[model samples]
Target: MAMTIALNKAGKRFNRDWIFRNLTFQFESGNSYAIIGSNGSGKSTFLQVISGAYHLNEGHCTWTDGATLPVEKVYRHIAYCAPYLELIEEMTLLEFLEFHQHFKPFVAGMTPKKIIEEIGMQAAAHKRIQQFSSGMKQRAKLAQCIYSDVPVLLLDEPCTNLDRQGIDLYYTLIDQYAKNRLVLVGSNDEVEYKFCTQRLNIMDYKSF
Candidate 1:
């Protein structure tokens, strides 16, 4: 498989101090990776750069070899799930799903009903997001990400608010959906460790 993402001599700084520097990595298609680090490390920053949410301060992040796509174009092929992103409060689960699907062309096998049934959120499908519990909201987010048919996935703390069964649901989806694309997860959960094929640790600037 060709390389999909690359960060060469990458580094980021807030104001006066370096968060991480001289960092390099290459990600290819058809593999899954997990990023683990201490809380203040640059894990989220690195993901944002790879996901094109932030511009690098030095060097550059590149997407190459496979489809000749730029960062945003590559991002279009990605489904990112982060706790900070808020869903539409007024939209029902079904409506919210339709909202997200508007970002790209629809896939043949992806249906909201299937996602609803799989995540066990059928009853809440018609309800507004503001009415959902934390776990329910997490389920809705999970359903949205998986149903989008985007191959590359960046999940930040994927199991938040999920019960044992809900966590199982995440693992099941990873097994089913991560066939041809790359999945990168930022998590410290032991269960997540089991599914990770490789681990990348974000070392703090102090440690470097």
Candidate 2:
């Protein structure tokens, strides 16, 4: 099924500060979107609202696949990754992916061992995540989130600590795996979201 997400007059705020308001948009399966804005412009907050991490102060966000998905179960269909989101540092690369599968299984034919290999992290598979370099840690995070079998993928600064080669691997995964899914990226760097088909600039809805 092609999943769809709709936001009608969506508004979110903290105290008197409005992030974005009166914004209506739709995100459909098989397309990728970029949430564009300068620093501190609420890009991440907006994505979180759709991820069910925050509630809109006003308006509504809906998920559908022919029928409207219930608020309580919407999370089951989405996979998210972010720079600040912590991983199980104590777990080895092999162990982390195995642990992830218990909650969100990887795509069919994909195993924990396969995911580690996919990210070229086989050399670090037996080491603890905390012992990894910044680039390696980011690769592990991406492996767990991107390799999961889901329709919607939300990435906030996905290439945070990646180097030149690591960045190339990101696009490789997207090309090979995310073609049919709904991918949303929050970033100002065009390189980070160059593959997205749509763009939402939060400044268009920002209020003082």
In order, the Cα lDDT scores of the candidates are 0.76, 0.92
Candidate 2 structure quality by residue, lDDT tens digits, 21-120: 9999999999999999999999999989989889999999999978999888878888898998899999998988898899898998999998888888
Quote each prediction's TM-score: 0.91, 0.98
Shift of residue 154 alpha carbon in model 2, Å: 0.1
Residue-level lDDT tens digits of model 1 in 1-208: 2448887888887786777777788887688888888876777777777788888778778877555667666667777777776889899998888777788433457776667777889899899999999988988877777656665678888888889998999889888877567778887665764688888887733324
Clashes of each: 0, 0
* Superposition error at 188 for model 1 (Å): 2.2
Candidate number of the best lDDT: 2
The RMSD of every model to the true structure, in order and in angstroms, is 2.1, 0.8
Off-target runs (Cα >4 Å) in candidate 1 are 1-3, 65-67, 105-107, 204-208
Q: Cα lDDT for residue 101, model 1?
A: 78
Clashing residue pairs in candidate 2 are none
Please give the TM-score that candidate 2 achieves against the real structure: 0.98
Clashing pairs in 1: none
Cα shift from native, residue 58, model 2 (Å): 0.6
Count backbone clashes in candidate 1.
0
